[model samples]
Target: MSRTLMSLVVLIVAVYLALCAALFFFQRSLIYFPQPSAVNSADSRLKLAMPDADVWVSTHERVGARALIYFGGNAEDVSRNVPEFAAAFPDYALYFLHYRGFGGSGGSPSEEAIAEDALALFDQVYASHPQIAVVGRSLGSGVAVRLASQRPVQNLILVTPYNSLEEVAVKQYPWVPVKWLLKDRYESGKYAAHLRVPALLLAASDDEVIARDSTQRLLENFPNGVATLKIVPDSGHNSISERREYWRWMGDVLNR
Candidate 1:
């Protein structure tokens, strides 16, 4: 091949690789961004209300053992889990937070924005309820860890979480440069390590999307002597809630 032609071809290949990397790192924005839609919770038995910033909350009871706030996965409605949570902690009040653009909430969704919303919700909930616990699954883990680090939380629970979305992107697209390209660095792993409250980290053995090691990385960040790590057998990323042991484990944790 001629020298000029060879050089041009190499340059084109490099540009293509760079573009692929950009797309890979920001893949979640490309994949998970969806317009918020108002979902009907009229039939829900739990008392529903929106106190701030396009977020919806479901409460089981005002007077209970403790208040529980739940953050859900990227595609999770979260309100759907109200019944299950109420069943699990019937005495304690249950709260579900809708992300900026998830489930009829206003504004666009971003990692920092969601974390701010979580902190606001935590503050609002904590103002009245002294005993507060935070629970998060998947993408919501980012919000949970951030809130725990910022606030005085009684307990923290993370399910099917990753160290960071950026890390996950790199794993999914090894050819891509995720570190520089990702706009939303949901670095839950970085925050989880410093939490002082009791923490529960749950990993799925059969999670095909997020590896167990990634979840372990988040667990490792937890401060010494206060973390409980559990691996659920035969459970995938989405099926952790379906397992009977999940409820039993949570009951034990809360009781502890």
Candidate 2:
């Protein structure tokens, strides 16, 4: 090769490698977008004392055996769901977890750390409310799926869930080596296979964030008859919950 051509080639390779290095080092920032909690009243908040972090849960207390635990999207403030969820499921106690570093929670978030916190939350909630139903939306879907797999959850609800975070990352950054660079691969599909309870997977008809194929792939992982997929009509990924049918479907699963 000519000297000029060789230098250009070297420069291009260096730039590509630098990009890869940057992605590897700062990938979590791309994955998690922490948001502040909106509802932070003393009565509604639950402080979960973890070894590394103090996680906060937005709760609606109800004296009953049934309860619903929610995990929100990466950038979502789960506390925002409080009023609607309280009115919709009045019989069931509601708990919406604000992930580590999200809302008022301390410490950084990772797949493993969030998983541990989820399990802890379940254990605590399950003490009084044995008939626990878990709901996870977007990124929280992965956390909920994994939690249901390990815990004796009564029902599982996944909203706009993908097969795996790695697959989504791969599609998002087609040029980058996402599989190798990803540190927190939330493989919901892998855990879905272990779930024995009833599961409801809610998909948006016009979801641009999570591909339809990704939701389908995750549904395929579940055992036959254990899970069902329902697409909310005329809705997008973030707007799925706005539809009345979305709550209806969720109510059907949780109530059953």
Candidate 3:
């Protein structure tokens, strides 16, 4: 090769190495967005004791035997979910987990850590109410699916869920080797096969983030008759809960 051509090749290789190193080191920052722990006016906060970290929870207190535990999106402050959860399930007590590093919870967020925190929280809540439902939206769906697979969840609701973060990451960064670089895979599909309880998948008709096929693929991963798929009309991934009939459907899931 000519000297100029050889020099160009060396530069390209060096740049590619630098990019891969950055992706390997800082990929968690790209994956998990830790938002400030903002509390809503209607929320009453509680701290659940975990071995390594303390998890903050937003609650809509209602004296009842049935309860609902909700996990929010990556950037979502779970406190905001209180009002809607209250309106949707008036009779059931509500608990929304503010994930680690988000919403004033202690420690950095990771798939393994959050999964452990979820199991601990579920065990504590299950102590009071034997009949409990788990609801997860977007990123939280991964955590919730893993929780249900291990625990005795009465009901499971996944909104705008993807099969795995790897799949979603691959969709967004086709050129990058996301499958190998991603640390917290959050492979909900892996846990779906083991979950035996009734699951309701709320898919958006026009999801700009998670594709329709991504959510459908996760639903298909579940065993026969284990999960039911519902599409919210004229809705996107974030706006699926904004549909007029959304609460009615969600209420039915909790009430079941």
Candidate whose TM-score is highest: 2
Worst 10 residues of 1 by lDDT: 43-52
Error of 3 at 138 (Å): 0.3
Score every model by TM-score.
0.87, 0.99, 0.95
In candidate 2, what are the lDDT values of residues 1-256, reduced to their tens digit?
9999999999999999999999999888998999999888999999999998999999999998999999999999999999998888888999999989998899998999999999999999999999999999999999999999899999889999999999899888999988788999999999999878999999999999999999999999999999999999999999999999999998887666
**Candidate 2 residue runs with Cα over 4 Å from true position:** none
RMSD of 2: 0.7
lDDT of each: 0.77, 0.94, 0.86
What is the TM-score (0 to 1) of candidate 1?
0.87
Tens-place lDDT per residue, model 1, 18-86, is: 788768566667636444333455543222233445555554556654889998888887777877888
Error of 1 at 163 (Å): 1.7
TM for candidate 3 is 0.95
The runs of at least 3 residues in candidate 1 whose Cα sits more than 4 Å from the true structure, single-residue gaps closed, are 1-4, 7-11, 14-18, 21-28, 31-39, 42-53
lDDT of 3: 0.86
What is the lDDT for 223 in model 1?
Answer: 80
